[model samples]
Target: MSVRRRASSVSLSRYARPGTPDYVTPPGDFCNAFWGLGDSGVDVLFARMRCAMTTTEELMSFWKERAILEERYARGLADLARFTIGKHEIGEMRGALDTLKNETAKQAEAHLIVANGIKTGLETPTLEFLRKQQQHRREKLTAVDKELKMKRNQEGYVVRAREKYEADCNRIKDFAAQSVLLQGVELDRLRIKHQRTLETVQANRRDYANFVRGLQEATQRWEDHWRAFCDGCQDLEEERIEFLFNNVWAYTDAVSTVCVSVDNSCEIVRLALEQLETEKEIGAFLRTYGTGNVMPDPPPFIDFENPDLQYDPSQPPSSHPANYPRQSHRFPTEDAANRNSVGSPTLSINARRASMTLFQPSAVNGRNGTARPPQAVQGGGSIPQSPSSQQRYSGGSNGSHPSHPPHAPPQQPPPPVPLQPQPQYPHPQPSNLSTPAPAHVPTSALATAAATAPAAPCPARTYTPIFFSLSPVQAIFGYTATTEEEFDFQKGDIIAVTATPPDGWWSGELLDDTRRQPGHNVFPSNFVALLM
Candidate 1:
């Protein structure tokens, strides 16, 4: 079975109505209200009233404190609004930001107004009314209590008056009895006593009646005043509740107004945000502060010892003067500094032929055992020889040995052999430039003539010139056959490696292609083994 439920009611407003002057009729005598239900009831009522009063007082105090906080906050916010944010803002952003600050200042002023309103219109009045209520309550209570005390005193007076009146009546009855029992002089005395007692009773009775009537009047007055005081106090309490309720409404209104003002200020900030052009600023910043459009060049290697010799970074590495030499197994000559590159106009390559015997001219490079002598070319002048070559070939016509140069070591001549007749060679004729000279000539006569010539030539024998593939050397040798590229090379590249010793070459002089010694001490020392 479905359980049906009532529809929920609409939520009540947070604000309450101010229902003032809730008149309540007095419960019996207002003065006796405390004691009517007993002392314990009085304690409970007092505690409840105290709790209610405290609640109201606390609410007022809280509102007062809240006002103080709002005032301080307004002051602080106003001061903060005076400062600048995003000081470097530009264009519309600048104007928009200024508007934001101005709007925020207005918001602060609104808050200040709200705080003042609470202080003057809510907290001030509520507190003042509470103060007056306390005083009025105290005064009313005092007046009621004062009247009650007088009424109680009147009750005591009435009791004494009754006692006095009854005592006087009893005394009058005793006098009457005495009058009935006496005669002559005693009768006259008794009659006088009786009249006096009667007179005293009448006086006491009138006084007692007056006292009773005064007590009754005082009670009536006190009761009336008590009821009025209670009603008045009740009105004050109700007024206090209504006043506080109204003050709460005022407080909420102030807060809501301030909140709306703050929201307006935030709306100004929103406008500022809308005017912001993030991309524009970012692009402008990059254009202003960026180094350049191109990437910078990488750092070049520099020599620690000669930093100034380093190449410029702006230039290509090829433009720098790093003329790296070619890597080769070089047999450097003794005059290394004087050595010429292969490209030099006159490159003199020193070669050595070692440990080989030379035959008589008649037996070496001869056709059919016939000898031919050296001849000068027709148009070309006599070939120049190095000083080293001249020293090796020099021989006097008189058959005497020549002395070696002082700096040069003495050469050990070949062991002497049996004399053989050397063939004679004819002198060259200019018209026959192409005529082939004999491969061999008389060593003694050729050396004699070479000594007299500008640079000596070797007595033509079996030795052959080792042809080099170098272009310049080929040109000198009249080789003009081909024009195609023969090789390629780069800086720091190796072109060729000269002869390296076979593994067992431990003690011999370096040799050339002819298998004859070139010279003593002509080898690259680093490649040769030292003798003990």
Candidate 2:
């Protein structure tokens, strides 16, 4: 009974225990029963699977969207690359065009230089040749005239020699005829005469021989000299002609070279112009793309008017105011309010005359119209009182109170006579001329004593106090002795120092160690010493 009761109690306790499986319920069956309710549990599982599938589909759609964007980005990148390549190509073409234009221009310039050189070379030789030819012609003509004059003189000398020879021969012939007819006393006389005739004949023959010899030598010399001169003249003429011909040839060659160079230069210029046109076209094209419009053509020539043409003196002058009045035109009458506002003199002619009357006293009584006292003219001339009169007149005219009466004449003060100092003369020397002993010793030895002589007390060395301020930091470091050091002090610091010699005091900073601060001494180091 106790065991059954214990068993019953254990059973009851086991049955009463919470969450214990009942003996009639199988675990598999219970699980099968709960799972078999497809309406709720299977619906929840299907819903979870459907949500996960939807998420996967959304992920796939997102990937597709990303792919589309990536593709579009790739296409854009390709387009940009193509654009960059196109720009690079365009730039390269432009550079090539510029280079070609520059090269063409350079070639044209070089051709022009060569052409100019050729032209100058051609012209210079031609001009020189012409000058030389003209000079040579002049020289040849002079030489020919000189030679002709020498020939004429030689012919004259020849004629004179022939006349002398003929006379001598005639005299000899007469003496021979007389000798043949003589006999007796005549024979003796004839013999002496014959001897005389023979002597005379001999002398005549010698003279004739000398004359003939001299003539022959002169003729030979003249012929030889003339022949040599003619030969020289021929050679010179030939050389000059040859030189001219050669110069002509050289000139022609140079001209031909210049012509050819000019032709080539023209061709080069044409080509350069074509290149320039092409470059301009390229520039226009580039500009069209850059600016979205064609550029306007520049004017062929600037229209400038002559600056000197603006003034036409031939035309009558404008009918403006002639000899414009000194007073303001706005105030036409003296009674106008603006009349005095212009500050111009409003006195009438009679009023000016009346003012001049104030000088009657000086003009009547003063010498040279000067009102100064007679003694004031010590230097032999009178001082003019015109300036004084003018001063008084001007003062009265421009004074604030225009209605005041004219100033009375000032009384002339007596001129001061400078007292001439009497000339001091030395006392007459005594016959002995004895010197007196010196009473004072030299002061050089007493310099120290003089320096120590209290300096006349110096009036207490008075100094005016000028207060200065300094920051706490600056006070710690002490005041800067100079303005430069003060300026260079750290930001928080302040400087205070007494500036001496207080009159007209000014201070400025020093830029460098060598630069002196105002009223300060620059030292060898970076320091500046204040000067009192």
Candidate 3:
């Protein structure tokens, strides 16, 4: 086995002779021979030693300086990372730096292997080894490039996420601004509606106060009339009793009989007193339930074309006769006459004929529903008036006009008169109740008139396209509702209109039952009307 000599031990003769022009000195041999003992003496030796020492000193100083530079660079890098990343992210950044440090150490080890192999080579430079080392270095460089691209991708994800968050924040702020604007508009509309309601309430209060005053006056007048009638009856009864006592025997066959007749008259007077007391109770009821104008004189006939007339509570009913004309007949039209003939309030020819036949029971045939004509009274005594006609007679005269005296026999009573031909006069015509007005009339007078009339039946719940004007009273009718969702109000309740819908319906709330909870309900507009 042979060992290779150092480059300085290589033969000079194999290259070229010293004298030949083609000869060249190798650097190591030339450097060694120049410092050999045969050349230049002590001065040369000193210079060579000093150069050798200087090279050694420079080599040691390079390594020492490199270590110091590396330490300073490491400290500067740590300070720079802390300043940029802050304390929270500093730990994460340190971990990444540690990974870089490990990779750099691996690269350094690979470079050291390449350097050692080059130094140990004894022949001509190993080109294959150098090529392999270059290839390995290129592969390490590619790996470092791939790691850098991976870190860049991670950073890009954070940037994209931040952009999305910023966009969402901006959209939220815009929505909040839009919501604030819409709420402001709705608030304004509610405020205007509230103001209108307040005004309506004030007007209603004034009308209510006026109604109360009128009711009080009406009550006072009725009380005065009742008191006067009672005083008149008492005075008349006292006078009659004095006259009867003075001529007791002349009037009847015995004193006991005269006394019995007087007792019967007193009993009739007691009944009259009871009727007057009943009327007094009715007056008290009217005061409590009355909410409209007190027009006891009479209800006016409503004409839509005429301007509304105001009801003045201060004026007496007698003063307003021109406004409310008395009807010539109880039923204004002939149709009304025929319709009411069976249960009519006032006497007519048919009613009188029926009455005349009643006193003569012998004229009526049993169960066959037939009657014979009544003959005139045999005596001069007058035929008795029916209960309907009795309403017109004075209180004291009613008892004396009885057909049969308490002591007289039934056989001796007066006979009935034959039926007389009824006199005919033209009947006053009533306006068609269903006709709609062409334009809106002022509500004040119409409200009073309707309130004065008896309540009418609720109109049918039909939807139609007809247009009409409605006074306050004309718009107040509602039906007796069976269910809560329907127009649930009393049969004669007055509904207050709040709004009208385009669907041919009106939205209203019940005002008649004050205790009922208030709520809006819809009803067909055509179904509602004033009492008139």
Candidate 4:
């Protein structure tokens, strides 16, 4: 039986007397019988039965004696159960307390941060600085406003001045037009007066010239008649004195007529002189009238019919030939001058060929008797001679023309000139073509030196046909992982390997126990081998 059941049966035995009906124990009284037994009684029974007793009489000797002991035992059992329960409660409480403590600490830290924020906000000077800046901005705005107002006032004044200037311009334009009209009228009047004065002067000069011519003719006639009268007086004086007196009277009449003519001539001459003086004054006045300075003398008169006045025939053709007929003579025909130009020396074909041969002895002679050298034409070197020249030169006899007609015999060959050895001069050979001998080195040593000379480094080699290996997991993921330990391997671990030396380095992911989705797995679960 279990220890508690055994103990309870023994306690019931101690509480009951032997052979009693309670000792016999009815089926329903079994629980009560076990409850009436004390813990000491159970210990005693266990001792008498030689069973090991975990409870003792000392344990049952408390207040209420056996009953109190029983109560105490029950209380002890309840307290132990309570203690075991409290241990689990304490563990749960401790976990909750730890969580609460962490939350509290976080809250405390947050509060400290808030306090620091408040302190920082209170300490900063930005608001005061902003206020000063706003005041400065207001001052600048006020200055700008004042300047704008001044500018507006100046612009108003400028507008008023422009209006006044426009009015003045209009007035000036009207005055200028009126002044131009007045000036034209005055100029016309002056011109008319000048023309009238010019006509009067011309008329006066003509009248004066006629009057002078008449005076001269009358004077000459008077002198001739007086001389004739003197000669006649000597012959008629004795024969007829009375007739001589009448002749003298007629002579006197003639003399009086001459005197009257002279007086009329003198009056005409005086009027002409006065008119001429008036004309000169009028001309001077007219010349000074409009011009600011005295008028210059008119150009000297040119004769229209003089040889110098005639047009020069040697002048170049005029651009407007229709207006100037003399230029038509310059158009001469080329045919008219060609005969004169043709007499000048020009090369014939033979002459040109001869000249070419003289200058270039190596030129190929053509059938037409023209020597055309192989010209160094552009885009290439000299042109090749015709194939006939090569055949002729290649023939055994130099004087035999290969293409000549059968009737023509071969010409005799020129005699060979004797050769003389030229005097040789000791000249240095060019260094590039003439290799220098090695300085006293043995042949074997020279060969060894040549063999030992370092050759240029060969280009770096590259690996080809590379192969890769993957772990089992990597094969599922279509990727491979590099092994962390060179020798160790796991079934699911990824291993990135290559057959060829890696172009740079091999790198891949590592696989752990963590499960991953298909296609998401970066590492191989098992080793995989790949062939290139």
Runs of candidate 1 with Cα error greater than 4 angstroms are 1-60, 91-103, 131-143, 159-208, 274-277, 284-532
TM-score: model 3 vs. ground truth: 0.13
lDDT of 1 by residue, 205-307 (tens): 9999999999999878866875676566556667777887887888787887787677657755654544344445656666767555454455666787895
Query: Candidate 1, which ten residues in sequence have the lowest lDDT sum?
Result: 472-481
Off by over 4 Å in 2: 1-158, 171-201, 272-532
Report the Cα lDDT for candidate 2: 0.35
Best-first order by TM-score: 1, 2, 4, 3
Off by over 4 Å in 3: 1-186, 237-249, 253-532
Worst 10 residues of 3 by lDDT: 389-398
Per-residue accuracy of model 2 over 426-461 as CA lDDT, tens digit each? 122111001121111111112222233333211222
Q: After superposition, how far is residue 431 of candidate 2 from its true place, in Å?
A: 99
lDDT of 3 by residue, 379-487 (tens): 6432211211111111121011111111111223232222223211111111112222111111112223323434433222222111121222232222433222235
Give the candidate number with the greatest TM-score.
1
Tens digit of lDDT per residue, candidate 4, span 1-532?
6565444554534444556654544433221222222222223322332221122222212211423333444344334433322233223343343434343334333333333332233212223333433453355324433443444454455555555555545544555455556657775765565556556545555545555454455434433432343233222222233433543354344435444443443333332222222234546555656344334454455577796686655754433212333333442544223322322111111112222223322211233433233335466543312221111111111121222111111121122222223211111221110112111101112222223433332222221211222211222112222221122233333533311111111123233324322111121111222211
Error of 3 at 530 (Å): 88
CA lDDT, every model vs. true structure: 0.47, 0.35, 0.34, 0.31
How high a TM-score does candidate 4 get? 0.19
Evaluate model 1: give its lDDT. Answer: 0.47
Using alpha carbons, what is the TM-score of model 1?
A: 0.39
